[model samples]
Target: MEKEGLQRSVEFFKHHNINIKTLVTDRHVQIKKWVRENMEDTTHAFDVWHVAKGMKKKLFALSKEKDCSDVSPWIKSMVNHMYWTAASSANLNEDLILAKWQSISNHIINIHDGHSTLFPSCQHDDLEGRERHKKWLKPGSKVYEKLQDIVNSRQMKKDIPMLSSGQQTSELEGFHSVVNHFAPKMIGFSFHGMLSR
Candidate 1:
């Protein structure tokens, strides 16, 4: 349905002589393939919110594991890193974005130097003790290993670069939220009423 909707919308726009240059969407494999094979002119990017949402869920699960409770403290920071990588990356260059995302593995363990040639070290000022960096995760430990695994997963390598850099679908999402609030699916409304909303 997503692919079909995208195709129909793209077709509709093309019929009206509107060419889409960049499309920000969740990481949908079929859409990726269709956009690649069908719409050569359009650039497809995955929204950072969806990417971070999945990362957060995985981290939360990892934190629940025995001996990995230490990871709980860094969950928010890890998620923020995803957002930061998307927002900070210029032109959504895949290599630079991937380099920045990979840096988190070292940063979480307080091993910041030599992260990457592209992003050699952490960019922010040194963390103020309590207000900034949390208790750092230990290196060569189970938590660190699991986190590194999650951070550098095969899927992450593909998805990190696909993250949208700016002008995401948040406004559309907000409009949907407002529609749900005013005209929830459970309640039926007349055509005029729904149209007004």
Candidate 2:
């Protein structure tokens, strides 16, 4: 189905009393526009990792113009911070972002589209002694961290069995074997032809 169709489905689901608090999706312009227009009440979050990856790619491309290896590592670290800031309920304070921005020689800050709502509560004004912004911890910080830890641990455990085995098998080899056995050939194709049929 098309974007509009998917959005209609989402609206239909909501109308039917489906409990969808937030919609996590990639940074598609159409989807963003649709959500902004139709689903104002529902929280929308762009995939943090996808955003970071895009930033990294752009940074790498820009690095070609400016001869600097050090900047690449810094860009990577900043991208990682974006992911962590998004994933963690920990607020990404404006001061913290400004600090990182100031540290970089290039104007990487300008590239930010400002679509992400998942940011630190503390604004630029909050840094001043005058404004009294509440310093309450984010609601789901601990839970988010715990969930990430669990996923990482599970992935590590899954990899352990693969690490123990010395014999390595390529997926390409398996694919080729299946294709050769299944495809009908002109010569000596008795069992293979039957299998294909």
Candidate 3:
């Protein structure tokens, strides 16, 4: 149904002679492939919020795994880092964006330097006493290993570069909320009925 909506939207835009230069949507695999094949001229980007939501779910699950409980305390900060990376990344430089995203692994261990040549060092005031109190992950420990895997996962490496840098779907989601208030998903309506609603 989502793909159908995208197809209809594209057709409508094409009918009106408006070329879409960039498109942003959640990381829907089918839609991604469709855009790749059908809208080759368009730059399709994944919504950062959606990607971050998915990442948080994984982090939450990992937080429960034995030897991974240390991650529980940092989930919110990590997600915020993703949002910051997506929004603050300059130009469309994928490498720089990725370098920033991957820097968190070091940051978690309180080693905020030498992440990548592109980013080099974390941009932060020197921590006065914070590092001394927290239980930072040891490099070879299970939690750190799992965190490194999560941060450098193949999917993250690919999607990190493709995150939408401008214009989020939050407004669209707000519109959907209004629509759902009128036409709740649990109750089905006919095509014309849905339109009227």
RMSD of each: 2.3, 17.8, 1.8
Q: So what's the TM-score on candidate 1?
A: 0.89
Tens digits of per-residue lDDT for model 1, 109-176: 77878998888998878778763657888899998999999998999999998888887878888988
Model 3 TM-score, all chains together = 0.93
Compared with the true structure, what per-residue lDDT tens digits does model 3 show for residues 51-143?
999999999989999988988878888988998898897465888899999999998888988888899998877766744566677889998
- Candidate 2 on 1-197: residue-level lDDT in tens? 34866578797897999966676655566877788787878766555554556656755654454333333444555565454434433234543433333222212222223423442232233233421231222224543233223223443233211121111224444675777665634456577566665
Score every model by TM-score.
0.89, 0.44, 0.93
Scored by TM-score, the top model is 3
lDDT on C-alpha atoms for all candidate structures: 0.87, 0.45, 0.90
In terms of lDDT, model 3 sits at: 0.90
lDDT of 1 at 44: 83
In lDDT terms, which candidate is top? Answer: 3
RMSD of 3: 1.8
Comparing 1 and 2 on TM-score, the stronger one: 1
